[model samples]
Target: MTSNPPLPVRPTRTAQPGFPWQHFSMRFSSTPRGARLARRLAGERLDAWGIPYGSDAHHTLTLIVAELSANAVSHGRVPGRDFRLCLSAEGTTLRVEVTDTRGEKVPTLVEPSDALDGDGGRGLLLVAALTDRWGWYPCADGPGKTVWAVLEVGTT
Candidate 1:
């Protein structure tokens, strides 16, 4: 079984040392629309941090968020629940996390078979391919999960 550690609750105050790290977060309904919003918001947040839209780093991070967020909405959605998108850029490393109210469905990465088409069954695979490292952990409440990925950004 994959080991999914539990995540600590995010404090109500954002005062931890190096805490903010240029971050932004939003909770959206766990729907297709929410997934789209997560991707757009990620780009906007990256832009605010000076990673312009369409830039390599921005594009890569957006794509990563897109896949992970979509997976959460599609595979991890729970009725009446929402998913969250959080972005943090510290120095050159940009961290992105998507959390959903589903703890049982941990993400796994595997090579896509030739029989698989590019349009399907490629989301997590793409995430694993693009992210420096990625994994899932139980949400602080113990009833949900969060999947996170990290990407390094620098002048291209």
Candidate 2:
């Protein structure tokens, strides 16, 4: 059997955390369609980085992206403003960041979305349960906030 060739930008699996070797960033319209695209592109990017499409890590990271992107489009939308999606791989961890222009409406795990009794407030809750850690903060650039999640990815 032949060994796989080294990739130009694949991060070392044991490298220090918080330093990514591969990164992908893009801005999408703050619409449901844009959220869907973010999820798909994020999955594709992970696959290109050697994670493959059907692996546990790939599925997990993609799910987190979907939830975050959906939230950005739903609660964080700012009329004509678009949301941004950034993905990076550092060591064995994958980090996803979704930025939208509505910093005033931050997400809280304690209460989640609208009504606790309703079926609409569990997005962040699902994100919290699935990922290793997740949080949000005002964007450093301009207006809006950045919701982020990190998952520890490993071979199954």
Candidate 3:
């Protein structure tokens, strides 16, 4: 009996208008230093994309990247696996996505607590506060998840 050939794999693509879209993506080590580098690189890219370094949009995006990257490193890290950072800018909205190698540790927003003595567990809180919207999803074609945040320019 002859076995059928394996089905061809299709690459995933994001829907976009005919207009040009700007995007940047990179993988970083799953470490604190890597998180720091993600924030720095994103900041530089934002500045280059006409968002001034000290503007509200720039600052907010930087904070979002910092928190999300930190969470990926702390909660989603796997040995010998690096996390991925992706940025896409279309029109006035910028989307930041960080994918890590731990799919089971999905992130959820937590209610604010009266007690302020905790040593950790506030990364998502910060992300929610800074971004216009944020969410997480398991990778469709891999063994990990991506945490994403979106910020709109000129929005408070």
Candidate 4:
């Protein structure tokens, strides 16, 4: 029987000093299936952190993850490269970041007139509506960028 090769491991950075935090990170293929997995895993992590499944924070964060992950797969895909999802919680803030290997395709908030009347161009809008803050930065290590969203979760 033939054996499959082990997947490549990706580096994950943790939080700096002064604040206690909980973190989870993983990389997924730049495909629709990977995006779906990102959303599911984020929901599971939030539940493990004591955020109830249906709470405002849990629901909001999950939605943000879904939208961001979908965008990464659709717009930021690089052949044979994967996208990354990172979740970090410190105090009342939950940060969600999705990184993809397409630095030049930096996302911008859609202007009212530019948005299509249909289903397209609404991802960032939902993100903006639900999260406390959202933005993106070009990755310093290589040819990619990380888009991040912050949501405020109340202590249980």
Give the per-residue lDDT digits (tens) of candidate 4, residues 1-156. Answer: 999999986333222222249999999999999999999999998777777677677788899999999999999999899999999988778899999999999898887567876658878988998888899999999999999999876533
Q: How far in Å is the alpha carbon of 10 misplaced in model 3?
A: 38
Select the stronger candidate by TM-score from 2 and 3. 3
In terms of TM-score, which candidate is stronger, 2 or 4?
Answer: 4
Candidate 2: where is the Cα deviation over 4 Å?
Answer: 1-20, 111-116
Distance from true location, Cα of 117 in model 4, Å = 2.7
Give the Å error, residue 66, model 3: 0.6
* Predicted candidate 1 versus true structure: per-residue lDDT over 77-111, tens digit per residue: 99999998998878677888999999888877656
Q: Where is model 4 more than 4 Å wrong at Cα?
A: 1-20
Tens digit per residue, CA lDDT, model 2, 1-156? 899997787555332234348899999999999999999999888877777777777787898999999999989999999999999887777889999999899998756535478868788888898898988889888999999998877633
List clashing residue pairs in candidate 4.
Answer: none
Off by over 4 Å in 1: 1-20, 114-119
Clashing pairs in 3: none
lDDT, model 4, position 130: 85
Of the two candidates 1 and 3, the one with more favorable lDDT, higher being better, is 3
TM-score quality measure for candidate 3: 0.83
* Clashing pairs counted in every model: 0, 0, 0, 0
lDDT of 3 by residue, 68-129 (tens): 89998999999899999999988778899999999998897666682245777677888888
